[model samples]
Target: MSEILLYDIPRKDPENGPWSPNTLKARLALNLKGLPFKTVWVEYPDIPSECKKIGAPPTSTEADGTPRYTLPVIYDPSTKKAIADSYAIAEYLDATYPTDRQIIPAGTEGLHAAFNKAFMDSVYFPCMFTIGPLSVSALNPPSERYFRTIRGDLLALVDSVRPEERWRKVQAAFEVVNGWYEKADNGKVLLMGDTPAWADIVVAALLVCARNLLGRESPEWKAVSEWHGGRWAKLVAALEGKVLYPGYGWTKQGGQS
Candidate 1:
């Protein structure tokens, strides 16, 4: 099979590669499927142009109603098709590849959809203040400049909060998420019990993002590792062998496009 090109926003750390949660979702999906691919690092400013060059559709609209192009676009050279959006990418891979251990799996779409929304609300947004600033520091110079320009208000908002308050909210957010996990059968590490699925990929991406942005030794990350009775720590550990870092399953290619 011809290599599927994965468009990812590169960070300064080449060894760790991409750090954004959403892009990691797509990358993790491809890794889980054992697909052959190469990472084409697209800087923040280049995402719109690169996506347009490949005809990857805009995933959303900006506040002013202009189309917004995002990263984590996969261009399958074999099929000559470009797909955008992480969850959509998962669905596409499951449909096109049809592995026995499918990402979406049959009859779980609605459940997964509900969990996605709940996870975003309960955990993702609330934890942003804690993790958001760290993301800026992780970016390459060009992407950092572009990110500051567009996300100034958000970064400022993150800075305005007291560190104590920010951490309190983060812990609270995870507490809510912990409740959801508790509803699963006893000792279930993943959302789908022993089986990993798209939901597991999503949560794992968040944990990986946290670990990277916060630094593994940082107190924030340490606290998270111990949260919910060490639930997240175990989840990350379980996925350590599955989630491929750079130079493992895929090669990083040069050039913006």
Candidate 2:
């Protein structure tokens, strides 16, 4: 089969490659399935245009009623299909490459969906205040400008919180998620026992982004790495060393083929 094309956003740190949690989900899924793919980096400001050019549908609408396109889009040369959204891309990959280990295993769709919703609400949302500001610094100049412009209100909200309170909330959010992981049978590293799946992809993606955003040696990263007896850190290490595809890399410029 021909290589799959993954659309992702670029960060200023070329050494770290892609950094968005959403896009990383797609990257992790592709690697876990052992698929051959290459990244087509999309700049923050050029996402809509690049997506439109590739026939990827808009994932949402901006607050101003303008259609909003997002990355984590995949264009499959074999199938001549362009899929938008990370979850949808996962589903497509599973269906097309059934021989590979399934991301959303049979009889677990509802469970996975529910887990994703709760994760977004309980963990991702709360931790945004702590991690979101760090993302701004990681972007290239145009992307940084675009991020600051579109996320002014969110940035304001982030700034409104005191550092101590932000840390407390971030800790509380992860603690709730850590409790969920603890419920997994046999103290497994993955959400699903003895196997890597969609849930693990969702989590490891975030952990990696956090490490990049916080800087691996920063105090915030150190605190997160030690959380829940180092469960989160171990999870990322496992994914990086064992599961995810090692071939992932990015072009210097975004929105280029």
TM-score of model 1 vs. true structure:
0.92
Cα lDDT of all candidates, in order? 0.83, 0.83
* Regions of model 1 farther than 4 Å from truth: 16-18, 245-257
* Tens-place lDDT digits, model 2, residues 168-246: 9878888888898999898988888876899989989888888878778898889888899999998988788756536
Give the clash count for model 2. 0
RMSD of 1: 2.6
TM-score of 2: 0.93
lDDT of 1 at 29: 89
| Candidate 2, poorest ten consecutive residues by summed lDDT | 248-257
RMSD for each model, in Å, please? 2.6, 2.5
Q: What would the per-residue lDDT of candidate 1 be over residues 21-118, giving only the tens digit for each residue?
A: 89888888888888888778889999999999999999999889999999889999888899999988998898988888888879998988898898
Report clash pairs, candidate 2: none
